[model samples]
Target: MTVKQPDLSFTQNPQWIAERETHWGPIEGFLKENNRKEVVEQLKKLFFTGVIDNPEDVREGFAILYYPLQTAEAWDYLFQDVRLNPKCFKEFMNASLMGSYNEKFFLDDEARLRFFDYFHPATYQPVIKSRVPIGREQKIVQIEVDRFEILRDMAAKFSQFLGGSEVPVIYYRLDYFFSFLDEACDVMDVSNNDKDDIQYFANNFLQRYFKIESDLEPKNRGEQKAFLVRFYNHIANNPVHPSIKAIWQKVLDEHD
Candidate 1:
């Protein structure tokens, strides 16, 4: 059975936005004095509701427009270290400034997906909706569902099961645990409230391996292999996603 993908799709091509006359690309092209008015006119009610394969090119000649200041900052942060949801974008558009530097951009299903894809930063988190209210009178507003942070928290929770300490230990033992973690987080079903349970498992795992610790320290290759072997079997014997299981298999294959 094929999983239905969520909308808000677009091809990621940095070519158009790259090597422009400026570092910010030709972002200012939409704000040209004589051209901006015509550009705004192209933004009909359904402006972003259509598919865009070549995000590098202007749509029917309409360059991507931004509210200038806050919008640019928001997009910078969105695709940068910080992640903001569509509500923040909607709010900026609501109280947009008088000049072109205002962030008055709105997103429909198609444009929202593509826009994020094109300007994607490593931290960008988007929530693609498969179903929404069907109506003519109701307005459709885009909402971003950012689980990236939560997923990291969940990964931390699992990491703690191998440690009596916090996140740094995960990085310390990333080699043994990365595949286990990459697969675990990809499942996306765990919660961040697994601290007590994690401690219980950590104690059991440490004592079983006779590596009892006051604070978790580095594990030797043998100890690491012991845990990964069980982890590999756990995935194989259980009902797991094929994609995740496949990735988990590589760690076992390569490590041996």
Candidate 2:
């Protein structure tokens, strides 16, 4: 299946995959060592903290993600590129981050912004200035949710990543999404109207996007009981729009 490609700095650097796998695996270790509070703090430091410490010039291979220190829209796109700050981890790892290989901890701009707003309701968001982590020593970036281009780019990029993937990736994306969105509701204070939009997006992305080139289909009767049992549990653990749960019930009825 030809997944759609949005405008992005898409690269297939085989080296980056090896680099991340060599260092970090899943975030479970990070989660295990740190309590949920500590995990949130570390994530804030990694992805939310953003700064342009080195203002000298663009590093050679990483121009796509170079930090634009000066302000001059006329200067160049290199300087004008206003992405969710990559200064946090990019500077530390010397890598072009993102993709399935990068230990899933890489929060896109949307998630970062969600985190920021949740934590700092009163503080006006800015290009956060992040330094090296005091203990973890991993650099990261910051982002916001108001930007449409970022989310479009993210959905497109994720579509590409997910187009021809396995079951685990689907599970990861869905699980991460519900968890993230569930928290975002609390953090961003999602109203019913806002949730309508979220519901629409979630429906398309989860049902339509994941099936672009994948073979994952609805389950059968033998598993329906197990499915419904967990459905209730998952809803409690990560409450999403009721309509979403309704979709689950719809599927269950159809199968029945």
Candidate 3:
């Protein structure tokens, strides 16, 4: 069954001023800036409401209006080391919110679904609508479930951020991960290796990247195999949208 995408509509919504003020403090001076206000209005219209109608139009609008603000430093830091920080997830959410706000203002269901397809917002939302009540407000399972949700959100957002870029440096970093993994495997093989060493290395790498704690043990061989199968299966279930792939190919070309 297909999942329904959220509608966008944030741009030009006068309510955004109050909404932003709650998080960012007083916005009198901010709202006073004509250019900034216009940008914010545009952001609300296109991002929040799905008014733009097409990803190509969105890309072009971004380039013409927003690209100057997107510095090389921002791109490099974002694609290279910035993704390692979980704090950036909030910014992504903010951007997504802005897009949806705009989309809702200017676009319809079909257009909104297209925008959702472009953004993959579902990957970042909470797993469940409400927690399953256990007893007396302890919520031990709820807390654990929430924590895992955060991790999954981070993983999905990180993948989207990297995958969303049209910058060469970004593609190089992703390609390097695959190459680095292959090279690391070859170098660490001892041939006399109990094979446990290979598992240890892979586990260690994932642990560090995923911020797994010291107490957690690597899954057994069968569990590990199942995980690999499930991860690939998940990828297969959700095909990458073509617009994103085109952006990636453009980045790859610059590298070549």
Highest lDDT, which number? 1
Cα lDDT for residue 243, candidate 3? 30
Clashing residue pairs in candidate 1 are 8-113, 67-101, 67-102
Local error of candidate 1 at residue 144 (angstroms): 12
**How does candidate 3 fare on TM-score?**
0.19
Summarize candidate 3's per-residue lDDT along 1-256 as a digit string, tens digits.
Answer: 1112222234346785455435333222443454455555554444333343333323222321221112223222222221212222333333332232332222234433332232232333332211212122322121111322222332343333323221121122233222222222222235523334333333332333232233223433333333334433433444433332233344345446
**Candidate 2 lDDT by residue in tens digits, 1-256:** 1112222221124564355344343443554564465443443232222233332322321222221111122112332232223442333222221132333433344432332222222322323333212112223334343322222333344433333332222222344433433433221234333444443443444453223234323432223233224435776566654555564454445445
| Model 2 per-residue lDDT at 61 | 19
Give the 10-residue window scoring lowest on summed lDDT in candidate 1.
93-102
Q: Higher-TM-score candidate among 1 and 3?
A: 1
| Candidate 2 wrongly placed segments (more than 4 Å) | 1-163, 166-178, 186-201, 204-214, 217-233, 243-256
Q: Which residue runs does candidate 1 get wrong by more than 4 Å?
A: 1-25, 28-64, 69-137, 141-242
Top-TM-score structure, candidate number? 2
Q: Kindly list the per-residue Cα lDDT of model 1 for residues 1-256, writing each as its tens digit.
A: 1222223232123452242224232334444544445443443212333233333333322222431112333233322222223343443222221112222343223333334333222332353321222122222345453333323343444445455332222333333333433333333245535434433443344342333334345644444445545655656676545544554454445445
What root-mean-square deviation over C-alphas does model 2 reach?
Answer: 17.0
RMSD of each: 17.6, 17.0, 20.5
* Clashes per model (N, Cα, C within 3 A): 3, 11, 36
**lDDT to native, each model:** 0.35, 0.34, 0.31
